[model samples]
Target: MTTKENNYTSLEVGTFESLLSRNYKGIEGKFFIGNELGLSGCEVSLNRLPAGKAVPFVHAHKKNEELYIITGGNGTFFVDGVEFNVQEGSLVRVAPAGARAYKAGDKDLYFICIQAQAGSLTQATHEDGIILNTKASWMNGKK
Candidate 1:
């Protein structure tokens, strides 16, 4: 189910298998969903690279740092000429100027990449959240 309300947007991207089946032209297994959600602060991409494939080139951010959450399979991440072996549980942070690239391993690799301005967060959820007196209607067990 997908919801588009005044305060937020919800997208049902389906299962991991659905995500991997998409091929844009000749490129397979990559989806950029940030614009679909009208994102303003960051860009998010869901990627599933086939075994042995790598991102075509290395890249670096001018102001944004990337956080890659590895959700499945294996890969080697290159940063500044250094290599780091990554897998299902790996979480990687690449600083704004760190040159980076990735290559998938023997099995398909799945990851979510989130990019936002480096050092730009002034407050986290705990610090920015407001305790509302109103109760959530969903709490009535009707999601």
Candidate 2:
């Protein structure tokens, strides 16, 4: 059986790259959607970073699992206290509550980042910083 295609096309990430002057500028991330035909359960995005640039801060997620699939350029990813060299064709996954950070190497870097939502709200703080969300009303407002 053949079914008619949807009236709208799936989001294309790479196509939007040209619309911006700097691939990674002004925002926390630079991204475009590729094909979200079968996307489910998790959030996916295409991220690009210029040479010598860092994405976000050095923090970890308390209840979110994330994976980075390197599509181009070199990316250095710090996972769980170790630094892993990421490049084209590299797939890195950071489990929930694990430490993770990434930076572009000497060249521009592009990759697809997949983040699976946690069952409940997640709180994350830097490795050396104080607990940003220590107080929780659900937990009797304890830190």
Candidate 3:
């Protein structure tokens, strides 16, 4: 099920355990949620690469930078001419012109990629957020 409230959208694609259990675009274990959630700021994708598998091509973004969050397993990341080891808890950021590629290690590699235009963030949490003078539905009277 999915929902789109006035100011927010909510949906559940699947659980973490079932992330790689479904087929996406003739391949198992890949999903993109930005479009489905009506996102305007970024494109987000969840991917699972099997052991010893790679992207098969090196590429660079024209204007968008990419942020990769390694969620599980290990992998090798190549950027420009540099290669490095990435494992769980690793977070990588590639600029718009950084040619990059990835290969899974000896086990399945799971990651999420968030893509957004470089230099597009003019305001951050402290500068763009507002504190409403209200309480949560469940915190109506609680301190």
Q: How many residue pairs clash in each candidate?
A: 0, 4, 0
Candidate 3 regions with alpha-carbon error over 4 angstroms? 21-27, 138-143
Name the best candidate (by TM-score): 3
Compared with the true structure, all predictions reach lDDT values of 0.89, 0.68, 0.89
TM-score of each: 0.87, 0.61, 0.88
- Across 63-105, the per-residue lDDT of candidate 3 in tens digits comes to 9999999999999999998999999999999999999999999
* Candidate 1: regions farther than 4 A off: 23-26, 137-143
Model 2: per-residue Cα lDDT at residue 44: 70
Error of 2 at 24 (Å): 9.3
Clashing pairs in 2: 12-33, 13-32, 13-33, 13-34
Give a tens-digit lDDT track for model 2, residues 1-143.
22226554444334424433434446444653323444445667767677798857677776678888888889799877898798999988788878788898997777788787765335444544665657567788555
Show pairs that collide, candidate 3: none
Judged by TM-score relative to the true structure, which candidate is superior, 2 or 3? 3
Error (Å) of candidate 3 at residue 23 is 5.5
Worst 10 residues of 1 by lDDT: 17-26
